[model samples]
Target: MKISDSFKSAIVEAICLLYILLFVYASVSKIIDFENFQVQLGQSPLLSAFAVPVSLGIPILELIIAFILLFPKFRYIGLMSSFGLMVMFTAYIFIMLYFSPFIPCSCGGILEKMSWNMHLVFNILLLMMAVCALLFFDKKSFFLRTKQFTVRLLLCTMISSVLIIILIFTFSEKIIHNENPFLRRYPPHPAEFSNAVRLKFNSYYLSGFADGRIYLGNYTTPAQIISFNSNLKDRKVHKIIFDPANTRFKVISWYVKGNYFYLLDGSIHKIFRGDIKTWKIDTELKDFPFFTRAIPIDSTTLVFRTNKGKKMTNTIGKFTNEQQVKVKYFEGLLQAQNEGVFDTDGVLMYSEELNKIVYLYYYRNGFVVADKNGKVENRGNTIDTIKHVNLKVSVLKNGTEYAISSPSITVNSSSTVYKNILFVRSQVKGRLENDQLWEKSFIIDVYDFRKNIYLYSFPIYHSSPAKKFSSFLATRTHIYALLGSDLVVYEIKNDLKKEMNSK
Candidate 1:
């Protein structure tokens, strides 16, 4: 259809007005809130490296384009520039929504409130208008000039290709490492409370697990050890036959290893050995170092986190030879934390299959992997970015010692290692996460110790009204969690089980 030049000129003039207004508003908004725009750019996955330059250059470019479109002489060049910019913006949004794992809030001005998908549509509409404006400028000249058309096509392709290449490079690195990107996958409820049994009291804590039965020790009644199977059907309470009156001993913790059960008393600095079947104490290991945290490695040996006599921070060590009870301290594990007493406080887990010790900290995104002999193996990271404890201390009692204002817990809330698979109840949430998913249950991030990489994460629902989880343990097939006074058992999802097996 042959359209009149007058009608085409009118359409082109209207398009020019749209471009001028759009650019003016966009540039003014960015200039007014320049620091915020700069920071948002700095957080972008693709623009982070060039944030400072781009932040300064963007508004200036927008203002220049706006002024150029306002003048009739420069309107043609302005339309072309606006078209290219809109195409670039559209591509950026598309890459962010699909390819990139982390999408930072960086769209400025009117685009800020719009969703990424909506912003893409808005850019696309503007791009179409820019193209139409250019086409209407001189209808016969643009179509008749083949050389001009070919040059413009090639220029657009090269610019678009470069933008895509940049997006690919930035997106690939984060997607592969899975770093702190905070991409969360919620599969069909990975875990659920299938069964639960009410205990005698809230004081009952899981002491150990062996032969599919969970053993519990009471702080109120130190002489009793309660045993219950995973099914919550069979229950037994055994009165621990130990001479507490003579030895002045108090049970700190207990665990089963091999054919025997060991009871540790940090107050008396002694460990008592007994048969698991009979629940009778027969042998005593004296001169054992005072340990706050203890985990049984084998029948004759045990691992502990202790601050024995010295003023040094807590050290990971093993005690073997029941007769002499020789303490071999791990020198390598003590130097990692700032203050070992509280900041380095964490869970000491032992994998029976690998015979490796994993110390997961409560105040950082790092953990220590060590061999049975206290040799350092490798240090690993959690998905969280918190590297140090967020603790505040104040001097008390005339500056002799400092008092902690708020005891900081930065990373792993609770963790357990079984068969080379590390299960952690993470306290810190990651990026690109759903707050509702975290609110419903405890987030359990699984890591493969052999690979030292995150495998997956699953949710374990809260069993009580308080929405607090005291302790949890994962076995080969089942997960036992102490939720208030009820012992809850959740079956591990088949896919997560397979993932762990593959690792």
Candidate 2:
């Protein structure tokens, strides 16, 4: 049966009208919610690096193609263009489905409601319609040829489009991780919520982890300590029995490692040692210098941070209490951006497994790794883009004290190291992240410091609206967070463990 020319023309016109409606509606919807569309693009695993230009360019291109479809002479060209656009969209969905770390939400407008699988199916149907429309147009048109030739051409277009998307995916990942443009890639379920237990007070800070138990120290009650099993099932409170007879201790910090615990009071230059089993102070070491921060290296040595010389610049030093106090300062480990004290203030963590001391800057996106002897190993940057510290300081009263004059941005809030993994609680929100999620939880970024690569990030949801994440400790399989009066635990999923083990 031969189809009439008018019927064929009507069929082609109908398809063209459908495409015009689709493109115009999609383009207008994106334009109406331009900011949202851009944010969605920024979250795309394959298009994040090109989000700015792609977000602006895509809608304009769609509108132009829709206009072209309305003209009779350019109808064929419009159908071809629609076919190519649909091919790219389908290929993008395909890559996102198979290759992306996690799938983001669909594009704006009606498509936003569709699941990724449904969106892929819809794109494929539209793509087939484009091919049909081109075939039904005037048979003499160059686009119409032998059926086999047309199939081959369409297949080539699909393959080429897929390859292009794959290339973009590879390049975007490199840019997003290394030279990030403030975008974050969130892999699904890097850390899963396990359980939480509420504490008596909110002053508990993570002291240490040993013998499969999480230890916490209370700031308000300096000598009090709390210990919990890995699953938060078993909880116990212990106190350090020390006699404060003639010693004037201003601040006391407890550090537990292996089978011994150390009582350090840098303010009065005193060190107390005790056995973890007895929890009693048995010995007081002499020849210790006045310092601000200290971590136990062993039974005899300590890693301390103190003000150096008259400048009071923050410096790291190794202290040994064998016969005499031997202090060795690593002056170059910390680089200051503003006032040496405030700008260089950060979290000091020592990884016993790696034998590396990690100093994570509070206001910046960099960290320094050093060996036990204060030899610098690697200076690595976080996924954030803030290189310099944004701080404003004021000289107080007698010019001896310095205080922050304005609110400063904190990049990495708290961190802990377990074996080869470094877990950092990041304060700054990345591009395309949910504001509600940020309000309700703390984002923990995981990095393999041994490999010097970011593994993934996950959220530790707040136990209560009033409680904020203060400090955390990481073990081989669990991350214990101290949020106000609550101690929340998150189980490390196998996906993260595989990455850590692979390295």
Estimated TM-score for each candidate: 0.66, 0.88
Q: How does model 2 fare in lDDT?
A: 0.83
On a 0 to 100 scale, what is the lDDT of residue 49 in model 2? 85
lDDT tens readout by residue for model 2, 106-174: 797999899989999999888878888776777565544665676676777777877877788888878
Backbone clashes in model 2, listed as residue pairs: none
Report, for every candidate in turn, its global Cα lDDT versus the true structure: 0.74, 0.83
Quick one: best TM-score, which candidate? 2
Model 2 regions lying over 4 Å from their true place: 1-11, 141-156, 283-285, 321-325, 394-401, 405-407, 450-456, 463-465
User: What lDDT does candidate 2 reach at residue 303?
Assistant: 86
